[model samples]
Target: MPILQWLTRDEDTRAVRSVPYRLLQEESALSCGDPDAANMLIHGDNLDALKALLPFYAGRVKCIYIDPPYNTRSAFEHYDDNLEHSKWLAMMWPRLELLRDLLAEDGSIWVSIDDNEVHYLKVIMDEVFGRKNFTSTIVWQKRIGPDSRAILGAAHDYIVVYSKNLEAFKATANKIPLREDQIAEFQNPDNDPRGPWTSSSNFSAQGFRKNQMYKIVTPGGAEYYPPEGRCWVTIESEYFRLLKEGRMWFGRDGRGMPRKKTYLKEREGQATWSWWSNSEVGHTQESKKEIIALFGASNTFDTPKPERLIQRILHIATNPGELVLDSFLGSGTTAAVAHKMGRHYIGIEMGDHAVTHCAPRLQKVIEGEQGGISKSVNWQGGGGFRFYRLGPPVFDEDGHVREDIRFPTLAAHVWFSETNAPWKGKGKSPFLGHHDGKGYALLYNGILGDRRPDGGNVLTRSTLQIIREAAAKKAPTFDGPLTIYGEQSRLGPTTLARENITFKQTPYDVRARR
Candidate 1:
């Protein structure tokens, strides 16, 4: 496999490791509607924000769509759309790595780009996400008309898609819904009792098979044989079975070649193709108009994606109530679409427009403002989202856990460090959760209802009993090797070994894992 190399390739590849995990500090005042909604809108650099989310959302997102700066070598009001080629690659490398870690095994990611750096982006994406997982590139016609000033009008942008695991993604992949024109193709020509249907001319396949070369006599008593270098789609016995079931068509006159009748009621959906026209999804001008409506034309977002484009992505890549993520949230089109379509989402944006553009747009969405795809999806919205900003890092300069870290925050980190998976702990007990046959407990910040020296932070005989009692309440039958993190342990090494217990001192063991 070929790898894309740049001046800072080595450092860029290792950048994710150097990114410190920060805390997501929620702004309650900025939040809207339901306070407990899983939807989040964060204001921070996406690299730090993604790293911060790993402890709680690793391998949980069903779909991720990112529209980063295109590096188009042109000035934009919102983003620095120009960058040195290698610097742009350097910036994207670590972010992609973190996004890959955040994606579920059966999940997929879609990235929007243009001719500026799409080929380079593809090469790096092929490296980060395995080349084998590369799905088709969708050529979205972003422009409805030709560019009068350019020699060759660039009318399309590429959406590069990749799945975490190709086979797993395919098992849950959805099909595109049939358009009105496609549905119009089906008609009840003969008034069949079953339903409206269209005839398929592929009754004969392009292959020579001995069993599939039998004759077929239509209802009109006209016999037909397989054409030259072709064979019937099925053997004689199967053909007769279908004919008895009225699944074959012989044209209105009943003397034409045999065809297969596919009923409209039986069709699931249309298979998605690589090309997408502006009529199917929307054009850049349409997207610009949507932004203008949301935030007045004076404060329009420069590179906002059409809500229908994101709608089409969510329709194919996810089901209702599934989780979606967009690190480069831009004008929050992905979040708005995901919300209207009933999917949980986390959108992260770096600029102040996260407060101005994205949040305001979503607020209108909650109010059921019928713009963009709102009318199409019947979006009478009644959900909410929390607003957050990147806070202090979990660890300090000397590599010790921050004193201000709360139990829930440290618990998430502890669980993730112990299991290499996202933490699902509810922060109600000292026992975080069980994973891979090992039970984990954290005795920090008075989790055991006592903050004395030997009360909760230290693992004494009494505190150990309380921990066991809490663990039993959660998982009564979970009697396995116990890994507990506390300040100190009173039990001797021999006693700890005999009890199948591993005691790790906090701030030391946790930092070591990092």
Candidate 2:
């Protein structure tokens, strides 16, 4: 595989690992509608938010759509869109690595970008996601009128798509729904019982084939052969079979070259094309109007994406109830679309607009605002999302576990560090659940609340008795070694080794990573 190197490539490549895991602090007051919703809108640096999400959402997201800054060198009120080439690569490298980890095996990622850094973005994406998984680059007509600034006006942008595993995506990738114009093309001219149908050219552009160059005699006794340089699409036997089945069509006079009738009943959907027109999806002006309508003209974000564009993406890439994440939650179009389409979503943003623009608009969505894509998706809208902020880093800048870290938070971190699995059990005493034949236990924040020297957070004869009782109830026949993390332990190394136990002292073992 090839790699794109920049000024800070080596440093930025390993940046995600060095990033400290931070707990997501939910703000009940900031969240709207329901408190137990699956969707989330996080306010913080997106890189930190993505890192925070990994312990819970790794390998679980069904789709991810991000519209990062285009590096167009223009200033916007909400963000700095301009960066030097190496700095831009430095910024994008780590986020891509984390996003790749969050995708399910059959999932895909779509990124919207313009010409300024698209070539570089492709090279880096090829490096991050394997080149074998690269899907086609869709050309979106974003504008209608030409700009007079340059010799040739720019009117389009690119959407580079890649699948986590191309083979898996191929098995379940969806077809596009037929547009009104496309449905109108199917007409029941013959009034056949098979329903409305459309006529398509039946000749192949390929050269002569053995059985494809056949002769057909029409009802008027006119002999027709394949055109001057074309051949029949199939062998004569199949053509005659379809003709007998009434799937073949001739002109009203029944003397023209034969064509094939494709019935609407036989179509599941239309295959998506690489070129997307503005009339089909949407354009920049429409997207801005939607923002103005939602925010009431005073609080518009820069370069908001059209909801129709995201709706199209969701229709093709995901199903209802699947998880979708947008780390760069600029104007929150992705989350709104995902919500309206009945898929769960997580949106992360650094700017304060996450509260002002993203959260407020979502509240309107829950109240049944019939704006962008609402009518199309039939969104009567009663679902909700939780709002979160990135808390202080779990390990502080000096690499020490913070004194304020709670038991559940520490247990989550420990389970992730030990097994790299999501913790599903209630954070309780004696047992933290088992994975890969090893049982984990955390005794932090004085789980038993004795506060004495031989408390629950300490490993003693009493603590061992509690552990044994809990394990017998949780895993009765388990004989695997128990890895216990605690504040202190009174058991000797000889006794600990004999009992098939390994005790790691907390705050000491945890802080060593820093």
Q: Pick the candidate with the highest TM-score.
A: 1
lDDT of 2: 0.86
Error of 1 at 123 (Å): 0.9
The list of candidate 2 runs beyond 4 A from truth reads 203-246, 250-260, 396-403, 424-443, 446-482, 487-503, 510-514
lDDT of 1 by residue, 1-514 (tens): 9999899999889988778889999998888988777899999999999999999999999999999999999989888888988999999999999999999999999999999899999999999999999987999999989999999999999999999999999899999889999999999989989999999987999989999999888888889999999999899899998888988899888888999999999989988999999999999999999988887889887777898999999989999999999999988899999999999999999999899888988888888989999888888979999999999999877666786788999999989888889998785689887998999999898776666877788988888888889989999999899999998899999989988999998877787134
lDDT of 1 at 295: 77
Tens-digit lDDT track of model 2 for 115-152: 99999999999989899999879999998788889788
Per-model lDDT: 0.90, 0.86
Give per-model TM-scores.
0.98, 0.87
Ten-residue segment with the worst summed lDDT in candidate 1?
A: 505-514
